[model samples]
Target: MALTATGMGSGLDITNIVKVLVDAEKTPKEAMFNKTEDSIKAKVSAMGTLKSALSTFQDAVKKLQTGDALNQRKISVSSDSFLSATADKTAQAGSYGIKVEQLAVNHKIAGTNVTDPTLPVGEGSLAFDINGESFSVDIAATDSLAAIAKKVNEASDNVGVTATVITSDAGSRLVFSSNKTGEDNQINLTATDTSGTGLTDMFGTGNTTTLQDAKNAVLYIDNQKVTSQTNEVKNAITGVTLNLTDADVAKTTTVKIEQDNDAVKTNVQAFVDAYNSLVTAIDKMSSYDKDKKTAAALQGDSMIRSIESQLRSVASGRITAADGSSIALYDIGIKTDRYGKMSIDDTKLTKALSEEMPNIEALFSTPGQGLANRFYDLADSYVKSRGLIADRETSYTNQQNRLDDQREAFSLKMDQLTARLTKQFNAMDLVVGQLNQQSSGLVDRLNSLPGAVKKS
Candidate 1:
């Protein structure tokens, strides 16, 4: 870049003049551009904040809309040592005397001592029939006691029984244990061998001993005998399941099912808390500061107003309950204050839930028109694609882009202005230099012509 010639003849600062002029043309518009850009950015950030708050509220709304929070049930036990009980929504509120008789045991059997586990025991097949299902493991004369057990355990078609070899000073023996517990599930093994089989002699010679007997779990409910193949007993009572851990023939306990109050209260309170939180967020983004006389980023935003109004209408409207009865949020103690914030009256809510929980559940999960359903729908409108909040954010982003374009154009304009000013000022300086030279020549010519007496 060529340097600008300052006022050589006219003593003017040409560069400084160009700069001041260019700044004069640029300052006001630049300030406006930056101010508009900042405002748009602020609005974009505010929209994101509102969208996030809407999502949080929707998370709480989902539980109620799906009836998970409404239908939650808890289990209680009378004597945990002997038995435990779990109840679900289908369980009727009632009590029953429970007496545990005997716990089911798995069938176990063992063969007589084998001189050596590593020596071959048999040469054909050891077929096991357990719980009406049968599977077999082929044996070879060279198959050892350990090998037979391994073959049985590793057979892909084998069902319930497991084979193992037990070695002790008493001698080495092959043991079989049944996976299922029932009289019918007793371990029954059939041996077919070619070579003088060691297994047939150990078992066919009446050397196999029954280690434990297969028996069903027996319990007496109100003195009515009940038997199960497993410890867990279901549907002995409607929606109630009994889990037996220990059995005592002489001891008695009780199974009780009742409505859970604390869980219902907690769920209602969560909904209220979520609503209040959204209210706080809305207020913050749309509030005006009196001391500073400044409005917030989203103040007077029509979208925010519309969202709050729609949700408020849903909350205040009545829901058509299952029994053809209409119920409102306030009927269950969910009230909205003048500020449009939700609050709960604990006493009123507890009474409503305790007296009519079915109706309350219906109020929040009545298919399409419940409070949770309506709120989720409304929030979705604002948070989904092309939603009000999303559209607003897009608008602000577009504004930011346009501002950038204008700023670039303005920058080019300032550069042009500076160039023009510098050119004009330099031209003026040249003219002044020529004029000073012409004036000096005239004085010199006059001094030489007439008896130009020196000023001295």
Candidate 2:
């Protein structure tokens, strides 16, 4: 609104003066608003970190609640070349002797070779019976050996038979094999011709060459006989699956299923690590730095203080055991230091695990009074949707939005004030310029009179 040559008329830096005055009014208010915004944002970030730490702690708690963690078993085989075994929670801890007598084999039959594989055999339907399930493939007069094999393989309802053409020094022989390994799963084929005798001439009604004989796997478990139609023998032993790789009648492999101490120890250590990390995060957020004269973003926050208090309470509390005794973490070799960090003693932990494992599990996994269950419930209240953390974040976001609106309104007011000040200064400069001109003219006129030029 003011003239671009602001100070040219009055010889005064009016534009700089207006800028200095406006800055003096605007800077302090804007700084206060920015500081409030930063503090709110930092609090929101700290809440997010708290939520993440709680989630990690909850995950660690979940591991101790499952039966698999408490009853884990590790299987060992003396000779892995013959077979390997896996044991589950239901398996009893014992050693068993296993002898592999024979492995199951699939039945395979090959038809006699022909002069030309591309030559059409005949228009017929080839039928097969596999494990009491019957299926057929329609053969056309123009269908070659390869085409017939493809048709047989493309049959969706085919139970356990696969057909292929094998090329040897003799010729390409169409072979059909049973996918299942058992005497009951033999592949028997019959051909019903319509036009020519090519089907009977090639494979002959009863002259199929046997490539492999179907047989059952025979084994001895602790000198007891066991037979299976498949190499994978399951249910022969409770919670154990024996996968036979080879047959060695003279050798016996010992399979030992025992409680997996290392696995349990690893899980315990993981829980300890998770707990320590969560405690460390909470401590940092809630602490004050006296040397720097600054407080953490979450310092003096009631919700954060409550969370830390509950977690520490759970860690220090005890649980009632099945023997009517109270068991604490320290009894199981898990101890907390002066700084509230937890650690495990390897030797002590192993001994406790061997002797008081059930009691230790009860401390963390007992139905409703378990330490893990309590921690899980507490953390869930904060990290869940529409929970404490979510509500706090929403409040902070509202504050930021209000700050943004205030900033916009403040800026508009400052612009209006600046424009008004500029216009006022320009009008004053114009008036001052006119006054100076009139004063100069009066001096000149007086000098034109007599004795006006004598004064120095």
Candidate 3:
């Protein structure tokens, strides 16, 4: 007694047939929606991969290119003292002490005025004017003379100042002296009340006096001033060279600090590889296939378009050279077609890199600046654009949610339809049973007296 619109048998019910047909259509729609969701998910994953690759490529490029595009720079170190850059590469110029023997050493002598043995004059104070900076310190009386001396030695920023304790038949007194032997090296030392209550009791204060007088020594490197007692000059080179001599007077010598070639080669190779990898990715994204559609995720993506455009613009931009002519990507052999896939014109690139490298570098990176400063900003912007990969992921996520909601709603509706069909089918089953009973009764009444053959 199944009800259906199109009956396979006479007993088929119409309502059941309609419900079955509708549910059948819903099943495929749900599957199709699921397939679409999966597709979107795949696209999101691909976008993330691409974005990650771009970020890595940008970092690599920045590392390789950031610097004075010039591979080598020569630094000269000279000292007035008899010192020179060691011929042996294993030696460090800093290890050699120039004019150290003549340098005045500060000696400490503990005053008899130490009223407290626990607070013995170990903690002392010394103030000195160094290169316009006022340096002041208070030492604990309990601190050993050696400990106090260590503190003074550690304070190298002060002008040629050093400290030590002198033990003699007279007793012990802390002495502050200038290591440099010169009028310029003369230092004015004044012990404060907090340092010890006995300044006039031990060392005279009130007048400008040399704490300890030693012949001021002079040192020159490559005719440049090297050292003085109160002299402010430390290294002739701005942190680039060191004076390695022991003489107190001026001496002429040379020290060579050369560019690290190995580092330069490593950076260059890294740049080439990163650029090539990025180019390969771009090629894959833009190329077409005979059996498949263009990478749909990249299709109509503004980020990809912008990246390609900027990269092309950078590649084509001109760089002004010292000779006044302009430099281009073509000059460097980094040529790209309208699609933006790149190939190294090896010979051209080599010639430009070797012969007119300054121009090539200026085009990609500004002179005297890191490589990133030149073209990395664009690459950075392209890679870090808003609503690019994140937007794609968000869109996919939204669609997935929407589809899931729809599927849930559809399932509920289908369940309701099935429930209604089941109820109607049950009702029809009872009706069929009643119809059979009525037909049986009519046949029984007709056959009561006369013989009747029933159609089976």
**Candidate 2 lDDT tens digits, 1-456:** 233577766988998989998999999999999899889988988999999999999988888875467657899999998999998767878999999999999999988887678888888888999877999989899999999999999998888788999888898789999989977888888887888877776666665789999999999999999999999999798999999999997899999998888998898888899999999999899889999999999999999888878888988899997899898888888999988899998988899877876777788888878887887888889999988999998998999999999999999999998999999998888877778878999988988997666667
lDDT of 3 at 419: 73
Scored by CA lDDT, what does every candidate get? 0.85, 0.87, 0.56
Which residue pairs in candidate 1 collide? Answer: 7-12
Better of 1 and 2 by lDDT: 2
**Residue 189 Cα positional deviation in candidate 2, in Å, after optimal superposition:** 4.3
* TM-score of structure candidate 1: 0.83
RMSD of candidate 1 to the truth, in angstroms, is: 4.0
Model 2: how far residue 338 lies from native, Å: 4.9
| Ordered list by lDDT, greatest first | 2, 1, 3
Span of 10 residues, lowest total lDDT, candidate 2: 1-10
Off by over 4 Å in 1: 1-4, 71-75, 105-214, 384-388
**Cα lDDT of model 1 overall?**
0.85
Q: Of models 1 and 3, which has the larger TM-score?
A: 1
TM-scores of all predicted structures? 0.83, 0.84, 0.63
Writing each residue's lDDT as its tens digit, candidate 1 over 1-456 gives: 222466886788888888888888788998999889888888888899999999999999988987757765676667888998887777778778888999888899998886777877767777888877999888888988888889988999888888889998988998999988878789888877667766687665377889999989999998999998888889877888888899998988877777887888898889999999999999999999999999999999898888878878888889887889889989988889999888888888888877778888888988889889989988888898888777787888788888899999989988888888888888888888878888999989998986778787
- Residue 302, candidate 1: alpha-carbon lDDT: 92
Whose TM-score is higher: candidate 1's or candidate 2's?
2
